[model samples]
Target chain A: MKDWRYWLAEQRGTLLAFGIFIVMFVIYTSNHPAGFTANVVQTAANKGVLLAFVAMAQTLVVITAGIDLSVGMIFLLTNCLASWLVVGTPMQTTLGVIAVLAVGLLCGAINGAIVIYGRLQPIVATIATGAVYYGIGLLLRPFPGGSVNEDLADAMTGRVFDVVPASLVVLLAIVLVIWVPFSRSVLGRAAYAAGSSETAAYMSGVPIRRGKFAAYTLAGLLAAIGGLFLTFFTYTGDAAYASGNAYTLFSIAAVVLGGVSLFGGKGSAIGAIFGALAFRTIGDLLFVFDFDPLWQPLFQGVILLVAVSLGAFALFRVRNRLEWFL
Target chain B: MSETTPMVGKSNGGIAGRMPKFIRRADPAVLTAFACIVLLLFLGSLYSRSFLSPEYLLQQLKVASFLGVIATGMMLVVLLGQIDLSVPWSVAAGAMMACAAAAYGPAGVVLAIPFGIFCGVLIGIVNGIGVAYLRIPSMIITLATNAVAQGLMVVYTGGFSPQDSATGAMRYLATGFAIPGVPNAVIIWALIGAAMVFVLTRTGFGRTVYGIGNRERAAYLSGIDTRRVVMIAFAVSGGLSAFGGVLLAGYASKAAQSMGDAYLLPSIAAVVLGGTSILGGRGSYLGTVAGVILITLLQSILSVMQMPEAGRQIIYGVVIVAMLLLYGRAPASR
Candidate 1:
């Protein structure tokens, strides 16, 4: 009984997700009147993988009660930069990927140093930096025009074993390499403690400053990963690859739905991945419904608010002890 | 009140030290921003000899008036230690409503003022209710309002620029010139700024705004109506934004559905740059004044130089970051 309680406590997000998955399975079966196909699953997984990387980046900073509005801008910039960097050059495509990741780290470091040294609140600081990053993208390509290397693009977008996408493999590698170590490490544990209560953590000898610096830096790097993945999805880049402003909401929406409290501390990487999948699936479902495409922005806002509100309500009830069931 | 005495020092140490302790803090944001404006002007003049003309400057000030007036209300909202993200939408709504009213001539124009004020109040109330009672964060509620505004504007105008007008006396607002040194709207904006300064310093409502902003729980405990104070703060912000929108309807000779979208970032930037706390209460109206000028001047300089939008945005971001480094830090925790 004790072990069961402990498992439930640690895996609440996963359990809630499983329950959702069951409901979704029943709904899809009834709607399609056929069992889920491999093709359908592959499509869902592909979209989920793209959003998952972005969501992971969002979760890292969000768990600290800070926001990185620049994530989308950084993604936009990196996608275009990657496309431009390896265009027709005999540069080892692998080396190009490494260089792109390095850029991501550098971008992340800039944000980390700004917040740590400049003492700007994460939201305001990021908003300003986002504009700058977008500007840099515009300079890279004044108009929206560029092509990706066909070979590399195919490797990323095409399936590895005809069942799993190459992009998915890279995304998994990221989760395995970065998110797993982060979730299990002692430093990761201290980061959680620091976020939970800065003063208490400081008193308990946790390095709050260092943890925040590392967290933001990782977020920046993850944003770069999101940008790289985007190049696979999109073969071209211009200044307007994606609306950077959207990141302010998408990242937030994913993490909040994934069960990370905006107030900081206590969340999971797997939960973030699920949340991103759910978010992307909703968008896909909207496409299936074939509503006016312009309704997308409004739909996104409503869905975001609904998802966030549900989380907020759950949090509020838990915090206020408002449960009334007999 | 005692806590804010230190804020005065944080903003302008000389004023705090030389003046009476009871003297309020001038917004350091305003001073720094003004310096930035002056520096930009000198650079502009140096780069292009013809940039310093009164006519050219008046044109710039006219553009600035739109943001400056709304920023007055934004200052009050920030003084209460909260944000109103709905300003962009509210401004858009006011412009559309005012433009619609202005179509009927003077009667419609006069009617537009109250109607505009009403819209602002309604939006403010909705925002306040969501934030205060429902306990949705102000950022989220106002952001949602922005989305609603975007949707509504698209529906109202059919995604096209609506014909409002500056054909009558309202044209004076858009293109009215006074002395060689001032545009009519700039003078009005200045008056509004002065009024804001007076309100923040002299009025009980203003002090309560600061009180609620600085410490909401303490303010409520001390018999201040903190929620009411916050509601009124949003209301004022909305009304002022509407006022700016009305003038805008006059200035542009018509209201475009998206005219207000650009004002939100700059207005909020002006407020923050002026040294008002993002959290609320300890700040200066003067600082916001500087913020408005700096932002306006930057836009003008960039426009004259024909910097691409991306590059301009980059510069704006960099300058803001630099300012944060200079003065935007939250005071080291005691």
Candidate 2:
């Protein structure tokens, strides 16, 4: 295959996921009572960004061929922390924001430390850490009532000049600032190499450990960003267990939908962002179509199953049965 | 070729020779779990005198039975190097369906157990087909299945609490003591555990599961029906999860939404804590039993201390990590 052809093949999953999201969004907007108006767009953006940020976080760890089950917990933990800290005057709020982000970084670091240095599997390590983060979150906001800096929350969650959603802009900015640089850097390539084949990466002298550690830490930061946005949106800190778990599950779905291979070493954060948007749209689509609200989980599951199954088409082409295990 | 063969044999012998005799004789995980249980018991005694009482300890045993049943199935899947994240809802579905069935009449009540188990079997088949045939990752497929089951149950209950109560038989099975002071739930768990131990140890099916987990291709090359094994493991996992749910419903007297949600992590934790390889193959039910007991006792103690749910979760996560660090660091023995 030509270079471009290989590139296209490489990006097929992301593109397909993107296509699915666009189609779903279009259908959703068209069927909505208000059509594609700013209000509708803003609401969708606000909801989608939260998942998109978290999905981006997931994409990082996933690209290293490891999963972080605690991303949702980190999101919850940060939101809980933000509720208490991001409430005072401007300087205090700034410090609070930094502290929350630092806490997220620390959470990610712990996960990375356990998985890498401790040589524990990513799944188990994250599950444990996720529990700890969630426990801390629960402790922080046991009653689910805390204030945020209202002015800051409203401005960030609100529209930018009454047109484009500010949250969307922030999401875009985050992509440019964090994801773009990381994806282009040496460490990012190392992460991809590690995900693709850790032994090969190590043999090639890739900084696999650092790359993976960076991926995990960045994942924490992204999840914290999501948490901040969540606090902004809800205007309070609630350590709802179900919601945390849902976000974790949904982020995985979005990652898969965005064409980021759960197997790792493939896919992009951008694709995952679209995947998150598309997943959010699926729920909204049901709402717009006047389906019973109770049917939402089933429909979402079905859609996710179908969407993920699309990625499985490649498996059928495998000539060796052994490849199936991989 | 002869020289290389001898060298390989010598190297293998040398490596084995370097290890202590006892290390080679026993699985370390079983011992660790045993120690942890003893330590937890000691800690519980330290915390409160009542905790060490037979009544309280038996209560913990009964609670462990619920997780034990689920972990038994989960161990099978984990042994195969796959997972069934659908457990949470499989459990809920089982409980809900069984309860709903019992509301019909005597025949419904009689069939309730089977009916609930069958619901789990159905979900298991779906999970199996997805993992074995469709070639999707079990983690993803089961997660999806869990959501689907949750959705179906929610719609079935019309978004309200389930109206059906546990059958008389179920309540008895969950809460009643059969041998005077022994909870029927514990007996049920023991029976299932025995069956599992037999299946995992005595049968060709057990050999195949270990073979597949160790290396599927090698197992398949050896003419073992790998896909069938995978399917069976998942089916068993689903069925077991549902069974656990049924017992839970009986214990609680009614099925509630998301009742199974709490079990997913703990089940996985128990399996791993028992010293089972999360990647698959090479584990024992005895180890898992110890793990279940330890976790149950820990939970009871924590609850007794009035630690909030969050604190308990933190400790739970910490304990899993600690166990993993202790056992999971070693490379898998092929």
Candidate 3:
């Protein structure tokens, strides 16, 4: 294949997911009573960005062939923490935000340490750490009553210059500042390399451990950002278990939809972000169609099933049955 | 013997001689589970005198049976190096279906158990078809199935709480004592466990599971009917999970919404804690039994200590991670 063709093939999943998001978003907005107004878009963007951040977080660890079940819990934990910390004076709010982000970073680091050094499987390790994070979060806001800095929350969630949603801008900024650098850097390449073939990467001196560690730690940071946004959107810190699990599940769905392989070594955060957005739009699409809210889970599942089934078409082409296991 | 053969035999014997016989002969996971059970019992007794009582202990056994049943099925899938995340909803669907069936006449009650298991079987087959035939990843497929099951249940219940209650037979199966001081649930679990043991140790099907887990390609090349094995494993797992849910409904006397939600992680935890390789193909029901017991005891102790739900969750997750680290780090035994 030509170089561009190879690149296009590699980017196909991401592009497809992006297209899905656009189509869904356009449908959603067109169906809305206000019809594609800035306010409606802002609300959608705000909701979509939270999952987008989490999906991005998921994308990082996934690229290294690991899954972090705790990302959602970390999102919850930081949300709970942010409610308590991101309040009062501007200086205090700034410090509180930093503290929440730092806590998220720390949580990710612990996950990395256990998975890489302790040699625990990522699924179980994160599930455990996720529980611990949730426990602390429960302790932090046992009754679900905490305050965040209102001004900061509004500024972060609201539209900028009366056009683009501020949350989308932040999401883009994160992509640029964090994702762009990491994906272009040595450690990031190492992560991709490790995910693709750890033995080969190790033989090639790819710093597999450090690369994976970075992926995990950065995943934590991204989840924390989601948590912060959750606080901003909800204006409260509730340790809601269902919501936490939902986000975790949705993030996985988004990752898969975005073209990031659950098997690892392929896909991108950009695709995951779009995947998240598209998934969120699925729910909104139901709302606009006046379906009973109770049907949302069923609808989401059916859509997910269809979307995922599309990926399975590739399997039919596999000549060897053994490749099925892989 | 040739000079090289003699030297190789001598070195092998030397290494064998230096290692402890017990370590070499026994599976470490079973031993660890046994130790943990003892430790948990000791701690439970220390925490509260009631914990040592026969009634309390038997009650714990009964409770453990629910998870035990589910974990048994989970182990089969794990043995195949795949997973069934659809367990939570499968359990729910089973309980709900059984309860709904019981709401009918006497005939419905008679068919309740089979009906519930059939529900699970149906879901399992769907999961299996997706995994075995469609070649989708089990994690995503099962997860999606779970969501679909949940949605169906919700729709069936008209978006409200389920209206049906467990029938007398269902209740008896979950709560009644067949032998003195032995709950029916425990009996059910034991029977299931025995059947699993027999199948795993004495049957070609069991060997196929291990073979597939170890290397599916090789297993297929050896003409093991790998797809059939995968489907059966998933079907068995789904049936067992549903049986567990039905029992749970009987125990609770009603099927509540999301009742199966709590079991998904614990089922995985019990199977993994029992020393089953999450990567598949190397574990025993005995270890799973021990794991189930230990977890039940630990839960009892934590509750006794007045630990909140959050604390219990944290502890549960921590213990699972601890067990994974302990066992996962070891080289695959077989």
Candidate 4:
């Protein structure tokens, strides 16, 4: 139980992020007299499904002290692959879906292979692969012209029931799937241990290489999920359109904002999701204000910086604040 | 390093005296970079006989020179353990400012290079302060600066490109071809590259920059003023990027607001391709020269091949991923 104290102390970023999210939700809900309708909640929840998934993938790799610069590129490739596969192909719909996921998984595996066997750094390797993958997608579809199956997109995007949005349901399902491995599994703890101290983690018998591989592999899978969402959301595959690489930095920011340390160790998947929601909520509200999109990048960068600064300040709780002066 | 290293090791044989060239093994990355360049060139040659012509090669050299000059500055910053993403816009800002200063005529022509360099240095200081003092990651801070700089360009140029026509030595810097067959821009880039190699290897500041990159805290603890070194590295980067802009203006016979656009990736690519560790601390300037040629060659090849723009970007990106993965993954910790 005493071990938990170190955790609570480390989680200031998570608390702050959640606090901000709740505040935004309250502000939006309170401003409208009717307040917090299913549609509004569904919209946020729907956005959350993909953002959180992508955020989780990025968070996992980042927590292992690596960055996947290629996640967006992978998403674009996967989305385009999925779109390309859907038209007049003899494969079953299930097989087609698998093929799309395979596109992402294959790319991720390539990333993993290079990162693991080739001894590449995550940032450099991913950036390079992303370019390649992006090129492949461009080759596949020089222009943005492809369609997702209407029925599948509709089903995937539709609300699960009257009370719960389908996207939220999917998100929860993903969370449930990850929770077991994340919390109870041996590999999971090793992931944290490896991130915390590679030498020590190795000395302590954590399979450092294997754990890192798993983390990246999982990140690849999760990025594919983001691609899957794009299939539903946009209802088309556009190679030229991007997952927006800024989101790569933003996801990192969200994780950092959620109080996940960039240097690895001490972070939570749930925290990342909340952080993403908090980030998106800010964007949503900003959109409501009708500010130009150009300002959004600058604004988001500022917010991310502030959030990190506050997190840094709170991490030391005045001790480092004094250290800054010293 | 290759010159001094083995001889130094022979004289001092004790444990502490044993030399460790940061490059411990025969690197596959250098080979990969070479292959990429060759492949691009081969494709270009296949695409058109003119691709191998001196006129075309010289033009390619001119392009390489501009980015190569900027890449040298970028490589230094990378050596210092940071990146300067604002170099793209900083180059643009330099061109625009130098073009604006052209109203001063012949004197302005000579002075434009320094003036552009000054804008870069000022921006570098701001970037340095953001990273070294305020401690924002160079990526985010420079991204903001990039946006701001570009936006400023939009406002200053009023969507029209800035034009400069320099008829004196300034034009000669970029336009005047050298002895035999070289374009002036190529000659200038080669001169700068050579000078940088000398500076990086011979100077105290250069050693300190590499030292600071290896471990900032350790350098500080060892009584090195890390902040000052970082500031200086960025200032140099700014100056070089500006110099590239100046030469670009001269070579083009006019300055455009977005002349620096193609430079961003290729500059970083050259640094990475050249075998400099993007993560800082373990690299060389000579590698940058190699990288510059490699990227320029590849770009020329692609352009000559006449592939679609998106395909070209993809090819470049994939090449980057390959290089990144094959070599130069930053280590897991500081």
Candidate 5:
């Protein structure tokens, strides 16, 4: 194959996800009464960014062929912590943000440690740790009330020059600052190798454990960032159990839609970000069409089922049945 | 783990005859879980005199029956090296549908339970097709179906709290005693448990489930219809989850939105705690029984101590991790 053809194959999932996002956004905005105005775009950007961050977190682990069930709880935990801490002087707010991020890193590290060293499966280990994170969050905000610095919240959530959403800029900056470096680094390659085939990766002497650990730890940091944004959006911390579970579940869906194989060893967070945006637009699509609010969940569910089923069409072409397990 | 393997093997040999043969041969995790149950009861008695009473223990067992039933289905899926994340909604769908059916008068009441289980089976079959035929990961497909089930229920109920109540028969099966000194729930659980044990040990379907779990490709090469086994396992999981929901609605006298939410993790926890491998293939029904009792007693004791929900959650997580650390470790492939 030509170099560009190889490149296209490599970037197929990401490009597909981006295309889906653009199509959905166009459909959503065209049907809206505001007709793609900046205000409408800003509102959608702010909502889409939350899941984007969580999905990115999920992408990191998924690349390592592992899943993090606690990302949502960590998001909630950091949100609750920020509500208590991300206040007062600007200097104090910075410290609080650092503290929350540190805690998020710690949570991810614990999950990594348990999975790598304790040898427990990622699914159950994260589920247990997720409960712990959620428990702490509940203790912090039992009744769903905590304040964020309005000035910071407004500035971060607002648009720049009345065109580009500030949150989108930050999302881009994060992609460059965190994702770009990580994906290019040796550790990232090891993570991919591990996900693709752990036995082969191990035989090749790849740093599988360290790579997986970094993926998991970075996932926590990303989820904490998501939680920080959530506090900014809601202006308070709420330890809603259902919401946490929903976010966790949605992130998985978004990651899959983004073309990240749940089987592990493929895809990018850029794809996941677009996947998240497209997923968020599903609810908006219903709103513009004048569906009953009660229909939102069912519509979202059906859309998800359809999007996920699309990924399965490849199985029909596989002549050998044994390959299905792979 | 490597170091202890030989030690355990040596102890089982004739040279080291100190430990009882039964103790040496039994699954250490199940024994440990039962020991924890006894310890928890002892701890509870210290907090309150009535903690050890037969009535209180029976009540705890009665409650555990619901979880026990749900975990039985979960164990089946897990044994197949897959999971069913749709349990929460499956449970809710079963309860809501059964209650909704009960509202249709006498015939509805008669068909409510079966209808509820049937709804769950439908959900499960969808999951099975996705996992078996479509080859989607069980984790993802079940999650999607869960959302679909949740949405369907919400639409069916119109976002309002469900208005239908459990029928007399439902209540009788869940709460009424068929034999003196034993609750109907306990009897039902025992019957289900007996059935599970028999099916797992005596049936070819059960053997195929274990074979597939251990290695699906190997099983398929061995002429097993691995897809059918997998699909059937998920279907049974959905049916049992709904049945558990039915009992819960009966216990509460009505079905509520999100009623199945609490059971999902606990059911998995119960099954895993009983020494079942989370990766699939190896486990026992008796071990699941021990796990169910342990978790139920742990909950009761924690409540008796007035432990806050936060503390309880933390403890629950810590205990699962700790137990997993003890015996749930996967073979060191990484």
Candidate 6:
């Protein structure tokens, strides 16, 4: 294949997700009562960024061919922790932010240790850790009331210079500061190699364990960022079990919709961002159409089903039955 | 190539052949689970005098019966080296649909039980098609179906709480005893357990499921309809999960939103606890029964001790991880 063709193939998933997001946003804005005002866009951006952050976290672990079921719980845990700590004086809030992030990193590291060293399957191992994380979150916030630093929360969640959503700007900064460098690093390549074919990667002398550990640890950090954003938006912490589970499930859906292979070894966090944005738009679309709010869940489910089925078309091209296993 | 062949053969014989027949034949995981069950029961007896009473034991078994039904489906899917994350909603869909059916007059009342199970089977078929024909991962597809199921239920109930009650027959099947002293739920679980054992041991379909799990390529090459087996396993799993939901609703005499939520992880945990490889292919029905009982007792003991929800969750997670570390490890390979 030509160089440009190869590049296009590599970026196809991201492009498709971007296209989907753009289309959905356009449709949503055109039908809205407010007609795509700055305030309307700001509200939508704020809602979308939460899932976008969680989906990005999911993308990292998924690139290593491992699933992290605990991202949502970590998001909840850090949000609860932040609601308590990210308050008081400016100095105290800064220290609290660092602590929350550190705890998130610790949670991710523990998951990595169990999966890599303890040799447990990723799915089952993460499920166990997820429960523990949620328990801690529940312990921290038995009820839904805690305060955050109001000034910091407002600046983080409000529009930047009355034009762009501040949350979107932070999300972009994170992608640049974390994702770009990580993807270009040696560990990222090793993680990808392992996901594609572990035995081959090992034979080729890949640092599979360290690479995966980095992916998982970074995933925790990203989820913590999401949790911090949640605290900013809500200004209180609630250890709601249903919502935690919903976020976990929705992140997976977002990742897949972004064209990241659940089987692993492909796709980008950028794509996942768009996927998350598009998914959030589903709820908005229903509102614009004046449908009952009850239609939101079904519509989201149908959209996910269709997006996922689109990926399955490749199966038809396989001539040999054995290739299906591969 | 010739020298390597003998080396491989010698290594296998030197290690495996030396083990005693009894040790080689038995499943250590299942035995360990049973031992834990005994330990839990003994621990519980210390909390209250009635803990060891026949009445208490039977009550625990009755509670376990709900999980037992769900785990049976989970095991079947696991045996195919696939998972069905849609169980929670499949269960809810079944219960809600059955209860809804009952509200449609006398004819609907008679069909409620079958109708509930059939809703689950339909969900399974959808899952099977995705995993089998479309080649979507079972994890993702099932997750989607679960969302879809949840959405459908929400729309059906109009986001308000469901008002349908379990039918008279449904209630009887769950709580009433056909045989004296034995609860009807336990008897139903026993029948399902017996059928599962027979199906897994004596049937060609069972062999095919194991074959697909071990190596789908080999199974396909051997002319087995691997896709069909996979589809059937999912369908069966869906049906069983729904049945569990139905029984749960019957026990309570009414259906509730998200009623099946409590069963999903416990069912998966129970199957795993019973020595069923989460990777699929090797397990026994008896182990599942033991796992179900053990989990029920453990929960009872924790509640009796008045542990907080947070503590209970932490312990539940820790126990699963500890047990997994015990015998669920995959054999080392290059």
lDDT of each: 0.73, 0.88, 0.88, 0.73, 0.90, 0.88
| Model 5: chain B TM-score relative to the native chain B | 0.95
Reproduced native contacts, each prediction: 0.43, 0.67, 0.54, 0.32, 0.69, 0.57
Every model: Cα RMSD to truth: 4.3, 3.9, 3.7, 5.6, 2.2, 3.6
Error of 3 at A45 (Å): 0.5
Candidate 6 per-residue lDDT over residues B1-334, each given as its tens digit: 1223344445557664676754445466777898899888887887798999999899999999999999999999988888888989988888888999998789999999999999999999999989988898787788889989998999999865555799998899999989999999999999999999899989999888887888888888899888888999999999999999899889999887789877777787898899888888778787888889988888888888998888777887888888988878866647
Indicate the worst ten consecutive residues by lDDT in candidate 3 chain B.
B1-10
TM-score of chain B of each: 0.87, 0.91, 0.91, 0.85, 0.95, 0.92
Worst 10 residues of 2 chain A by lDDT: A308-317
Per-residue CA lDDT of model 1 for A58-132, tens digit only, reads 788777666677888888888778777755655766677778778878877788788766777776788778878
Which residue pairs in model 5 clash with each other?
none
Write candidate 2's Cα lDDT for A5-48 as tens digits.
Answer: 99899888778878988898889989999999999999999999
* Cα RMSD, model 2: 3.9
lDDT per residue (tens digit) for residues A1-326 in model 3: 79999999999999999999999999999899889899999999999999999999999999998888889999999999999999999899899999999999999999999988888778767877888888888988888888889999999999899999999999999999999999999999999998998889998888999999999999999999999999999999999877888898889889988999876899999999999999999878988999988888888888777766665444875778667655
Q: What TM value does model 6 have? A: 0.95
| Clash pairs detected, candidate 6 | none
Question: Which candidate ranks first by TM-score, i.e. highest?
Answer: 5
Q: Which sections of candidate 5 miss by over 4 Å?
A: A312-319, B1-16, B159-162
Q: Report candidate 4's fraction of native contacts.
A: 0.32
Shift of residue A165 alpha carbon in model 5, Å = 0.9
Lowest summed lDDT over 10 consecutive residues: which window, candidate 2 chain B?
A: B1-10
Candidate 1: which pairs clash?
B30-B287, B81-B280, B274-B287
Q: TM-score of A-chain in each prediction?
A: 0.88, 0.96, 0.96, 0.88, 0.97, 0.97
- Give the per-residue lDDT digits (tens) of candidate 3, residues B165-219: 9988999999998798789999999899999999998999988988898889889
How would you encode candidate 5's per-residue C-alpha lDDT over B115-174 as one tens digit per residue?
999999999999999999898878878988999999999898996555569888889989
Per-residue CA lDDT of model 1 for B1-334, tens digit only, reads 3454577677665656887543453344555677778899999999898889887887887888889999988888777666787887788787777767666766876776567657777778777666555566666667666666666666556544555654455567656776665778888888888888888889988788888787776777777666676777777788888778777877876666667767876887888877777767777776777788779988888988998888788888887888777877877643
Can you give the lDDT of residue A230 in candidate 5? 98
* TM-score, one value per model: 0.87, 0.94, 0.94, 0.82, 0.97, 0.95
